[model samples]
Target chain A: MTALLVSVIAAATPLLLAALGALLVEKVAVLNLGVEGMMLMGAIAGFAVAHSTGNLPLALLAAIAAGMALALLFAVLTLTLQANQTASGLALTIFGRGFSALVGAGYVGIAAPTLPRIAIPGLSDLPFVGPVLFGHDPLVYFALALVGAVAWFLYRTHAGLILRAIGDQHDAAHVLGYKVVRIRYAVVLFGGAMAGLAGAYMSLSYTPLWTQDMIAGRGWVALALVTFAAWRPFWVMIGAWLFGGIMYLALYMQALGVPVPTALLSALPYLGTIFVLVLISRDARRIRLHRPAMLGRPFSAGG
Target chain B: MLSLSPRGTASEFWRYAAPLLALALTALITGAIFAFMGRPPLLTVTTFLVTPLLAPGGWEALLVKAAPLVLMAVGLSIAYRANVWNIGAEGQYTLGALAAGGLALALPDAPGWAIYPALMLAGLLGGVAYASLVAWLRTSFNANEILTSLMLAYVAQYLLVYLVTGPWRDPDGFGFPQTALFSDAASGPRLVEGSNLHLGLIIAPLIALAAWLVLNRSVLGFQFRVFGQAPRAARFAGFNENRLIWLAMAISGGLAGLAGMFEVTGTQGQLTINLGPGYGFTAIIVGFLGRLNPLGVVPAGLLLALTYLGGDAAQMNLGLSSAITGIFQGILLFCLLGSDVLITHRLRWRVRA
Candidate 1:
C-alpha cells in the first residue's frame, strides 16, 4: 500500500509541476502549447548536468534554464512576430523534441545521480502518513508547496489580479498601463521553468536515466490537466494525482496479468484524457466562464 | 532601430517571396548550427541538404517519400482552410494502412485489379470512420479536436501494435513482430524498371492538382474560404459548420489513409512494429510551408522530403544525430512564420529625429 502511494506521488509530481506552468500561462491568455517540448529539453539538460557534475541543485537549475530558453523563443514569435499561437507552439514542441534528442543522443542508456531524499525527523515518525508523505525528495514537497503558492499568488495578490485581467481583456489591461506584453513574458517564462522542473523530476528522481522521448504523453496529459482543473491551481493537484493513478493503473493491470491487451492498456491514459475532456467540454457555458477570454489571441497595443 | 508598420493591404510580392526567404534563412541558420557543432559548416550544410539529391537513387527515394507527404498535406491544407485542426493524421494513416493490409492479408491470392481497388476503398473508408470520431465529438460536445484527435492517435498506434505483435505476427518470420509479406498481387505493380517509384507517385500529384482546382474554383471551396476567413459571416450566409468539419476531417483522414496504403503496397508489403516516422506531424509543416495551397504542396512536400533523406545521410556520414532533421524542420517553420509577417506588414527603418 505504501509503495503504491509512493509510486503514485512520483508519477503525479511531474504532471503537477508541468500543469501548474501551463495553468499560469493559460491564466495570462497565452496558450503556449510547447509544454511537451520544454519538458523534453528540461529532461535532457537536467540529466546531462546531473550525470557530469553530480550536483542536483545545479542540474535542476540547468533544466529550468533550458525550458526558459524555449519559452523565450515562443515569446519572441507569438508576442513580437505575432505568429499564430497554435502553430508557434507546435514549432516549439517540434524544436524541443529535435534539439533534446540531438543533445541527449550521447546521454541515452546512461544513469545519473538522483536528487537526495530528505526525511523530516519528527514528522516522519507519524503513523500511516509517515512513510508516504515525509520521506520523499525535495521536489515532491516543492510541488505540493507550489500548489498553495500558485493559489495564493493567483487569488490574494494584486499581481495575480492583473494577470487574470490581462487574460480576460488584454487591451483594457494595456490601457491601464499594466505592461501586458512584459507580464506575459514573465508568466510564460515561469511556466517554462516549472515544465523544466517537472521534466527533471522524471530524469533525476523518477527514472534516474536518460532516454529520447522519455516523457511520452505525460506532457500532453499535463496540458489536459489544466482544462480538467478549469485553470484552478488546487484542482490541478487533484487532477494530476488522479491521472497519475490512472496511468499507473494500466501498469498494475499488466503486472497482475489481466486479460487485456497490453497495448490497449498502455493507451488508457490518453483515452481517459479524451473522456474527461468530453465531460468537461460538454458544458460550454461553464468553460466560457472560467476560460480566459483572450486565450490564444494575439494582443497588440493600440492596434 | 527597425520597426514594423501595417501596409493596409497584403503585399503580393511578399506572398510569393515569403517562402523563398524563409528557405534561404533556414539554410543560413542551419549552416551556423553545423558550425556550432564543430563541423565544416558549408560542407556539412551541402551534404545535409544538397548532396542527397545528387546521390544515386536519391531522387527516386525523394519521389517515394514525397508521394505520401503531398497526399496528406493536401487533405490537411483543405481542413486548415476551413479552420478545422485535425492533427491526428498519423493515427488516421495507421488505421488506413491496417485496414488495407488486413484486406490484403485476408485475400492475398485475389487478382491484382480486383484486390487493389478493394484495398484502396478500405483504406479510404477506414480513415473516414476514424476521423468522424473527432468531428462528432467537436460538433456535439464542443471538445477540442486538437487534443481529442491527438489522443486518438495514441490509441490508434496501440491498436496497430496489438495487432502486429499478437494476432498478426508472422509464424515463419523467426520471432519478429510483423505480418508475412503480402502476395505479389497485393503488393501492386511498380511503375519503373528499377526504382521504388510506383503508381502512388502519379496519384499523389494528381490528387494535389484536383484538390487545387476544387479549392480555387469550386463553390464548396468558396464556402471553406468563407468559413475560415469569417465564421460569423459564414453562419449568416447559411453555411453548415458541422458538415464542413466532417468534410475536412474525412478529406484529411482519407488522404492520410491512402498514403499509408501506398506505403504498404510499395516497399512495406507487411505490417511491422517500426512503422512510425511522424509523417502526419511533418505534413502539418508541409501544409503551412505550402501556404495551404494544394498546388504549392508538391514543391513543399519535396523540400521537406529532402530533410528526411538528408537527416539519414548526415547521421551516416557526419555522425550527426537524427534529431537534427526535426531541429531543421522546426527551424524552417519558425523562419516561415517570421517571414510570413512581411506579407501583411513591412519593416521600416525609423531614425529618431
Candidate 2:
C-alpha cells in the first residue's frame, strides 16, 4: 500500500506541474490548447540533451526552452496575429508532435541519467510515512512548493489582482492601462516553462528514457484538470492527484493480473477527464462565475 | 512597429486569395524543412506535390484516398457551419466500420446485395449513435463537446484494439490482430479494371453534391449558417440551439461512418487496428481549407490526399520521417489562419507611441 501510494505521487507530479502552468494561462484569459504539443517538444528536447550532455539540469532547461519556443509561436499566432485560438492550438499540437518525432528520432532507445531521489534524513527513516512523504525526487517537492507559491501569487499579490482583472474582463483591464498582451505573453511563457519541467520529469524520472509520444495525452489531461478545478489553484492540485491516482490504480490492476482489458485500462485517463469535465460544467452559474470571461477571445487594443 | 487595423469591410479579394497564398507559404516552409533534413528541397517539394500525379494510375489512387476525406469533410463543413464542433468523427468512423464489418463477419452466408446495403446503413447508424453521445452531453449536461468527443475517440480506438486482439481476431490466419478477410460478395466493386479505386469514388461526390444542396437550398442550412455566424441572433430568431447541435452531430457522424464503411469494404478488404490514420482529424483542416462548403471540400480533399501520397514518396526517396506529413498539414493550417486574418484586417506601419 505504501509502494502504491508512492507510485501514485510520482505519477501525479508531472500532471500537477502541467496543471499549475495551465492554471496560470487560464488566469490570464489565454486558452492555450497546445499544451500537448509543448509537452512533446519538451520531452524530446530534454531526452536529447540528457543523452548527449548527461547533464540533468541542462536537459531540463533545454526542455523548458523548447516548450517556451512553441508557446511563443502559439502566442504570436493567436495573440498577435489574431488567428483562431482553437485551430491554431490544434495546429501547434500537430506540429509539435511531428517536430518532436523528428528531433527525437536518433535519441530513441538511448537511456539517460535519471534524477536521484532526495531522502530526508530523519523523516525518510520514519517507517511507512517516510517513503511516501520524504523519499521523492526533487522535482516532486518542487511541484508541491510551486503549487503553494502559485496559490499565494494568484491570491495575495498585486500582479495577481491585475491578472484576475484581465481574465475577468480584458476590455476593462485594457482601459485601465494594464499591458494585456505583454502580461498574457509572460504568463503563457511561464506556463510553458512549467509544462516543460513536467515533461522533463517524465523523461528524467518517471520512465527515464526517450520514446515516441512519451508524454502521451498528459497535456490534454492537464487542460481538463484546469477545467475540473473550476480555475482554482487548490482544486487543480486535488484534481491532478485524483487523476494521478486513477492512472496508477489502473496499472496496479494490470500488475495484479486483473481480468480487465488492457485497452480499457489505457483509456481510463481520457474517460475520467471527460467525466470530470461534465461534472464541473453542469452548473451554468458556476462556469460563468469561475471561468475566465475573456478566455479564448482575441483582444485588439484599437477596438 | 507593425500593427493590424480592423477593416470597415473585409476585402473580398483577399478572402479567396488567402488559401492560395497560404498554400504557397506552406510549400516554401516545408521545402525549407526538407532542406534542413539534408534532402534536396525542390525534389522533395516536387515529390510531395507533383510526383504523385505523374505516376501511372496515380489519379485513381488519389481518388481512393480522397474519398474518405471528402466524405468526412463534407459532413464536418456542415457541422462547423452550424457552430457545432465534432472532433471525434474518428470514433464515429471506427464504430461505423465495426458495425458494418461486424455484420459481414457475422453473416458470411448472407446474400451480398442484402449484406452490403444493410452494412452501410448499420455503419451510418453506428456513427449517428456514437455522435449522439456528444449532442446529448452538450444539451443535457452542458459538457464541452470538444473534450467529450475527443475522449470518446480514444475510447473507440481502444475498443477497436480489444476487438481485433480478442473476439474479432481471424482464427485461420497466423496469429495476427485482424479480422477475417471480408467475403468477396461483401467487398465493394472496383471502379476500374486494374485500380483499387472502389465505387466509393462515385458515392463521395454524390454525397458532396447532396450536402451542397442542403446547405444552400434548405431552411436547416440557413439555421446552421445563422447560428455559426451569429449565435445571439440565432437565439433571437427562435432557432433551437439544442436541436441544431443534434442535427449537425448526426449529419457529420453519419457521413463519417459511411466513409469508414467504404474504407473497410473498398480499401482494407477487412477491418484492422489501423483502420483510421487520422482522417477524421485531417478532414477538419479540409473543411476549413474548403471555406466550410461541401462543394469546396472536393478539391481540398484531393490536395490533402496528394500530401499523404507525397509523404509516402518522401519517406521512400528522402528517408524522411512520415511525420513530415503532419508537419506540413499543421503548417498549412497555421498559414491559413495567418492569411485569413488579413481578410478582415490590414497590416500597417505604426510608430511606437
Cα TM-score per model = 0.98, 0.97
In candidate 2, what are the lDDT values of residues A220-254, reduced to their tens digit? 88988888888888888899889989899888888
> Per-prediction DockQ, in order?
0.83, 0.77
Pairs with steric clashes in candidate 1: none
User: Over the true interface residues, superposed, what is the Cα RMSD of model 2?
Assistant: 1.1
Task: Judging by lDDT against the true structure, name the best candidate.
Answer: 1
Off by over 4 Å in 2: B349-353
* TM-scores of chain B, in order: 0.98, 0.96
For B205-319, candidate 2 gives per-residue lDDT tens digits of 9999999999999998999999998999999999999999999999999999998999998788888889956898889889888888899899999999888888888887778
Q: List the residue pairs that clash in candidate 2.
A: none
